[model samples]
Target: MHMQTKKNILFLFAAGVMLAGILGTSCKKDAAPDYGIPTITRVAQPLDSASIVTGSFTQWVIIYGTHLGSTQSVSFNDQEVPYKTIYASDSSVTVQIPRAIPKDVTNTVTVTTKGGKATFSFTTVIPPLQLTGMLNEYTAVGDTLILTGANFDLYGLDTTATSVTFTGGSTVNIAGGTASTLKVVVPASAQPGPVTVKGIAPLNISIATVAWYWDNRNFLFDMSNFNGWNGKTYLSSGPDPAPVNGPYFKVAKSWQGGWAWDPFCSNNCAMPAELVNDPAKYINYALKFEMYTPLNPPALPLKLYMVFNSGNFKEFFYDAGGGSYPYSTGGKWRTFTVPLSSWGNLQGFTFSNPIIMEFMLKDSNPSQSNFSICNFRMVPIN
Candidate 1:
């Protein structure tokens, strides 16, 4: 009986060991597949497959490489970029280089994935085309425009490609150029509006539209040129007025007093006759003028008013006491640019006709105020 029990115990122990081995084998988890280290082969545009050596801000880029689907992050010059996972695949990924200023040093594009990380060298570029000022805002056909700014093809190597364009789709030839300046002719077909300069690669900059009514004898009222002023009743000759150098008109008023000036349209004014009949042309146009206030009265509130031909008008008030406007009573010239659109709809008003501009003091105190006016004209905004 003892021998039989020992045999039964040995058989049961062997059976238990086999059952445990089967359960262990069935429950064990499968090992994950390995994706090799990521490698970047080429960077190109998705549509044309054209290789890209440099990239612009917000430009779409496709990166061709191996093991890219697992990428967790991408960056430009250590700055992490936002990307879409749906555009990524095992062999490639589509992304946009962040819209930001490029670093001075060499730029590197990096991709990180569960498999590994990869990097590629690239050149980042930004086109900065800003037009600071023009030598002459008003120019006749075939006249020259001196454009001042930075990042122009100053060497004039590619004049045909580098050009100045007008709103009418007319392009002007680049006569000369420098790093900070460009000389371009006003094409005969060019209309009076904003101008754009095209630079090499990605640079394109535009400036405010050229002035429609510029500072000339017909439009400007200065101590030297008083043709635009209505009369001399409310105006007096400036102090020791020299013809070319002194202020054109000196206006004096006591409390609750004012004066008016009307533009002289019969003179050599350059405003187009068509603009007077069409109020649409008045959009984006502004009246710009320079004013100098004497420091006699420390602070004085002033009100400016404009009356249109159709009996429509608008008023802009400046609180001299609060320094609301940037004018100081220290006899310094300050240019005020007031947009015509500030007055509501001007559909039926005739803009070319004589408009009355008046300035009056708002203060109740019995104090005298004096203001000098110069260089009044109309300029474009866009």
Candidate 2:
């Protein structure tokens, strides 16, 4: 190694380092991006990708724009909603509107990113207060008339207001309610027709009802009205929770006797043309009745299936969807519906001819049994 060669190498390396430093100084690196002031274009729903200017609280929506990839906060009408990083991106933030009732509704969706805050014109509205159905249409006076649906709480139904009007024009406030249910005692005068709900946003709403409060449409027989083929040995009046009709077919048996058809059978009876004409349509018709099984002692809280039959068709009642056998209402005179589709035999067993509708107890008993039931009418469920 020559000393001159070593000196030349050191000089070349120094020159290279100085040039690199000069270049680095001249070409400055870009400052870290703060994704300057987020931008929002339009909001849309995830399904069908439909653009929406307004949406229900708790509904999911996509906020479209730039700088959202670093979203620090997302809110619908100023109400912050929780979101996962996985569902957010620079161009979009997918979030659900907070269910909290809107107070000072600004009607805008806001997004805040590291850069700044941006907002799009959006209205977070309360879901429509819907009264789907009365749990038991024949709810007795002073009995709780429970109506089920969504957004009962959001509506903040001014119960004292004329929010709930019954069939007979009797307006009552909701006594109790949750998100999906509104309960009012059945007014002694409430009739049978469509009920009215005046306390809603934008416009008052009308709630359609099934047969209501002692309404007998395709009238079958009750204990007070049935063919006396089977004597009313078990006909009973309340001190049950409540009673809808005058007398109900309460099983006043040692129920250890189990399985028999005497008290439940109706003679070869005729049904309304609607119920008899199209057997295929029977699937849409429900056999509804007020039923109560005392859950406490002496009132045998046995799980029993309400075996019912019309002609050769045989089935039982439980949940509205049908056939939850060895079943009990647990308690209360709630109406029970058994879809005839469950009675596959009825699929073939329509009454172009006369037939017998009978009720029987199952041989399988919880050692003791008692259930009060009445108003067995076939009503259009659809």
Candidate 3:
């Protein structure tokens, strides 16, 4: 009986060992996943496919190559940017360059994926200087004028690296300003011409050559070379209401009428015209004139019509709709601009001789006729 029991115990041990081996084989871990190597061939702008090798900071770009869909990290010039695996694909990855200023001067973009890493030659370009506008174009001497735009700090614009020149070839001193605005003190030498600006190394810009101050570029009737034709008038030599560069045309005439065609024009002043003697080119220009009306002025403004020339074509000093210019300076001299192109709707139009401009009263009942007009000129709006 003892021998038989020993044999039975040995058989049971062998069976148990075989069962353990079968369980081990069934529970083997799954093969490790296959992750392909990643590489970047080039960078480009999204949608346009424009191969952009270099770009400014914070500009969005696409990395094109193989094995990028599993991107784990992206860096421009060693500046790591926030990225996601979901937004990436095996062929391309869209990312934005970080806004932070990079300390690492490595002009290359590095990308790392589950498979491998890639470093692409790329340069980060700085923002360039751009000019927009000059504030208070008619700034008096010693007064502060501002230049408006972006990236003023980039150039360190001051009296040193930046310059401000007026139309007549006079430059002003910088008064200091912020990143988007530049302040300058207008010198006594500032003339009436296009404003010019210069900055460090290849930064030169010119603006407003024909639009700011009242100039003599295309002067017409300013009560000097060309006087008024007919109207009760006198030149304002001034103290009261202040004197302009020149006296108002036949200063202050009492205009009283009820929708009547009252006349005021240059008796024999025919302009020299613009652009190769083509007066039609005046259409591109702005007709500017200084006008003054006494306090509590007219309900409807003055009219310039071809009543003596063609009768159908007419324009207002302002865009007052046909002959309904409701402009009033209220006793202070103010410049009025009338874009000649605004008259494109006036049929039967042509710039030629017999340019008899008849200024009429447009009110059903207008006040006195002593309105002043001077410095008629055609200038660019710039």
Provide the TM-score for each candidate, comma-separated: 0.42, 0.64, 0.49
Q: Write the per-residue lDDT of candidate 2 for residues 1-382, one digit (tens) a residue.
A: 9999999999999999999999998899877976767899998988857788998866778888987888888877757877562267888888887887665788888888888899888877666666666677777679787777776556655344436777668888877667787778778788776666556554344455554555576545545665646646766677664567778877756544445443444444556587667777887776667777665544433333443344355655334323433345567667665666765566665654345565645454434446677777777767
Q: Model 3, range 1-382, lDDT digits (tens) per residue?
A: 6999999999999988998998988899878667788889999987779888898867888999998877899988878878652258889888888755466779999889988899999998767556655543444567677667766665555444577777678876566766688777777877766666666554344333345643567665446544456532455545554556656554344455666655656343344455325645656666667666666544235553423244445555344324444545556565566776675653335544435454544456645555666666656664
RMSD of each: 13.3, 8.2, 9.9
Model 2 worst lDDT window (10 residues): 317-326
The residue pairs in collision within model 1 are 154-177, 154-178, 222-248, 223-247, 223-248
In candidate 3, which residue ranges exceed 4 Å CA deviation?
1-162, 174-185, 198-208, 212-214, 231-234, 250-257, 264-266, 292-313, 320-333, 345-348, 368-372, 380-382
Report how far off residue 370 is in candidate 1 (Å).
4.0
How many collisions per candidate? 5, 1, 10
Candidate with the larger TM-score of 2 and 3 = 2
Pick by lDDT: which candidate is best? 2
* lDDT against the true structure, each candidate: 0.59, 0.67, 0.63
TM match of model 3 to true structure = 0.49
Native-to-model Cα distance after best TM-score fit, residue 167 in candidate 2, in Å = 2.9
Question: Model 1, range 1-382, lDDT digits (tens) per residue?
Answer: 6999999999999999999999999899978879879999888986878888778767778988999988888876755676563367899978887765543445777788889999898776765655555544444467677666554542232355676777578876678877676677777777655676664544343344343312342342333454543434544455522212344445555544334343212122344344566668777566666566765553233444444432566455433335553235365544455666766656556664445554444434344445665555666554
